[model samples]
Target: MSEERVGFFTDTSVCIGCKACEVACKEWNAIPEDGLSLTAMSYDNTQALGASTWRHVAFIEQPRPEGRTELPLAQGESTAQETPVGGDGELRWLMSSDVCKHCTHAACLDVCPTGSLFRTEFGTVVVQEDICNGCGYCVPACPYGVIEQRPHDGRAFKCTMCYDRLGAGREPACAKACPTESIQFGPLDELRERAALRVDQLHEAGVTDARLYGHDPDDGVGGDGAFFLLLDRPEVYGLPPDPVVTTRDLPAMWQHAGTAALSLLGGLAACFALTGRGRR
Candidate 1:
């Protein structure tokens, strides 16, 4: 029997930016530690996803309400805006956990020269590290810019959606560790149904900005296996507003190229025949 399609429904509205998902991911995957450096970009230290960093949580601090007090600065700190505060002003801090989409039409799988990227029985995407040649084709083919080459190993890597855990009938570590149930994992169809109801509930509660991203089967990437319910614009969480599969137009491009080449060859043959006749 075919395994049901399992995936993630990351509800950004409920995420607290605690980075528990990040920690759980690294622990389960045995990924290298990344606590060495501070980039001075908000509370975010692990900036983006890579081989070592499978799950990244983005922190976006929105300025307080208009005519609010100027944010106080530390004695020796930069004068830039401080952490968002809602006590005296209407401040909103947006936090989101980003992962590989495991797209329905996976561009990484299409561009993997070594056949390292493969689809799982659960309808997720995974990469075989030993089989990877590190060609880096999949890096650019991904519209979300999720895949990356490890510095030491030079092998492309991203979230596997915890294929191993799924096989054992367990949820991905990140989802299991989420304190707010923000990162929900289950059958894709069921999640979609549940997410819709959540959105409706939020709307009824006067949260007009609530919306779902990457859930449509007819979307550009044919929909993401791991989708999201966002309270703000996708860009607010460092997600592309519209992600399109990079390989969607390859067949049409090749067809046009072949037609042009055939036309050029026919013209060359005609010229050669005419020259031969004149010489005779």
Candidate 2:
């Protein structure tokens, strides 16, 4: 579609712990290796999205909770038991490759001093490496903590939504390389519709915790370009359950500051008038 723009709709329910997306992201972006040492945690060595690691696949291992299904439990065990089936229980690993949300009301864009970070016609935010100048203002400005400054160059980096590839009418390297189609890239509108349908499907399949994150336009960050269908609370994925853009209150804050200044000036003037009368 000529008018359609590209975006990501990550279905975390079916993500199978493959790190192919992470590999594709690093390879395509030419991002530096953050070391291959195994983490004490699960299979995830790369913890999260940073300057060196643009796409991080999170691995969470947990016993599948009961009570959501109608199946009968084994002898002497009730379905509501939080304990595992065996002595340890059946373990399942949830995997999701995380990236920059490309938020609609991006705080990074709001706080950038240089014109390096700009919004494209596709409605994605990207930083021009040459123009960044290592200000580091965009780091904390992001509510999601998705962007970061590279250790070597100090310039900030995150997912660009593959601007160059999108311009060439191709999918992002991560999406293309994904084996299970967990990371699906397409027009945002269509993806949202599809995500809703998939959520319904999951609900029918007894996965009632299935919910969409960052899909609504009225959300805190005005929605995200790269949203997800998470299987649990957002915190399970290390995301803020309710993330408002950091600068959403800028106008109101400035107004309050102005009022406080006026109040202080008025108090000082009154003091001066009383002092002058006493001196006279």
Candidate 3:
């Protein structure tokens, strides 16, 4: 609306698996701390995004064979030929910080029975806690599985895209806290352009797998206020490959229902008319 406001441009390639963004978000937003128990699933303490954890850092470790054995070398036997060092064939770590997408056509906003969820002038979606009736309609409406109900309050919550900070003309705390600038925030259009250039740069650097996700304006949800640049498939990062807004089919569904209702009424009227004629 206002020259297309900016949003996040997370470069997963630069993320160092640091939970600083996660910690900062919790600290600044006064979010409750989730359990510290580790799932032994990589180094990620916070397994995923939830009511308490907004920013989740995913750590992925890939292993590659160091050598090519001609005759299936024994467990302890070293191959006579050295395979290679770190290169195209070598394994590397891929880290990404996941957060609410703030979709353009947010289904959560559409499905909210109350006006708890609404779009801001910045075109970001926000849930008004005071207005939320805790009906939980928004929880599943989100295609990205973002908004969730708090256990204690039963009220839905999610990242506000740091609306207060944006209002104060300050960048989101997570973006500011990122040491490597992995999370950059600005106007959505500008961020998209920047993300595209970053993808190109990564490709040129032989990181051919680097690509942008959720940045397409023509995408199912229109586009996302917060998008990402990833080094692997979205599902590898626990994100959906193709997220269609759940409410996209609502209009067609209603139209079909209306047609069916009309046809039924017309049939009833014809039956009544034929019966009346017989009575006459």
Candidate 4:
């Protein structure tokens, strides 16, 4: 019997800029503290995800649309806010938790010399640290730049989607600790349906910018195991506008190289035969 494919559906609209998911992820995974210094770029302390930081919460402060006095609250509710106006306009915060996509066509898996990165029974990707061998081939191969090597050891690390917890039939700590239920986890198919419905709800409530990312199976990386519902452009959240698997053309390149090698060998053989006949 096979396990059903499970993944995360992160709804960024409802995220309150809380770092509970980040804290829960670190505690559950026993990940080391990467840093404590503030980057001075908003309220974000851990600027981005890295080897030691498996989860990162991004805080983007942008100018709100003019005359938009009310903001849509979670679960399709709207509330008027007495927000302060910046020099440009009224500032609104966009918060999102960033993690590994666990791509269906994982480029890290394709480039890893060792069998360190693998797909789990639940259809998520995981890296076995003990087997990594510090090769670092997977670092640049990742399209999302999710995988990273520890500075001291060079072994690659990234989100495993809590493989151990999944085996124990529990949700990931990030999702469990999300107070707003922004990070929902369940069967991939179910999550997709739920996300679509959420998008429709937001749209009907006048949030026209609501959209889904990495949800389509026909996407360039064959979709992501973990997807997101965003209220703005993906780039605003520091996500790539278009992501393709880094190793998508490897098979074709190898086939062309083989053909060239065969052609060269045939030419060499013919020359040798002519030389032999001439000698005779």
Candidate 3, superposed: residue stretches over 4 Å from native? 2-4, 64-83, 86-91
Q: What is the C-alpha RMSD of each candidate to the true structure, in Å?
A: 7.4, 5.8, 7.4, 2.3
lDDT of each: 0.85, 0.84, 0.83, 0.88
Candidate 4 at 220: error in angstroms?
0.8
For candidate 4, write residues 1-280 as lDDT tens digits: 1899999999998898889999999999999988766888799999888898888899998887543445466564556354544456467888899899989899999988889988899999999999999988898898888889999888888999999999999999999999999899999999999999888877765667889999999998999999999979999998999999999999999999999999999999999999999999
TM-score of model 1 (CA atoms): 0.89
Cα RMSD of predicted structure 4 = 2.3
Candidate 3, residue 267: lDDT = 100
Error of 4 at 256 (Å): 0.5
Please report the candidate that would top TM-score against the real structure. Answer: 4
Clashing pairs for predicted structure model 2, backbone only:
none
Candidate 4 residues lying further than 4 Å off, grouped into runs, are 67-87
**Model 1 agreement with the true structure over 1-280: per-residue lDDT tens digits:** 2899989999887788999999999999888886635558688889888777899988888854433233212122323333334555476677889999999999999888888999989999999999999888999999999999987768987898888999899999999999988899999999999899878766654456779999999999999999999878888788889889999999999999999999999999999999999999
**Tens digit of per-residue lDDT, candidate 2, span 1-280:** 3346558999987687789998888889888888866688878898888888888899988776664423212123333323324335656677788999999899999999998999987888999999999999999999999999987879999999888888898899999998878899999999999988888766655567889998988999999999999878899989899999999999999999999999999999999999999999
TM-score of 3: 0.89
Best by lDDT: 4
Query: What root-mean-square deviation over C-alphas does model 2 reach?
Result: 5.8
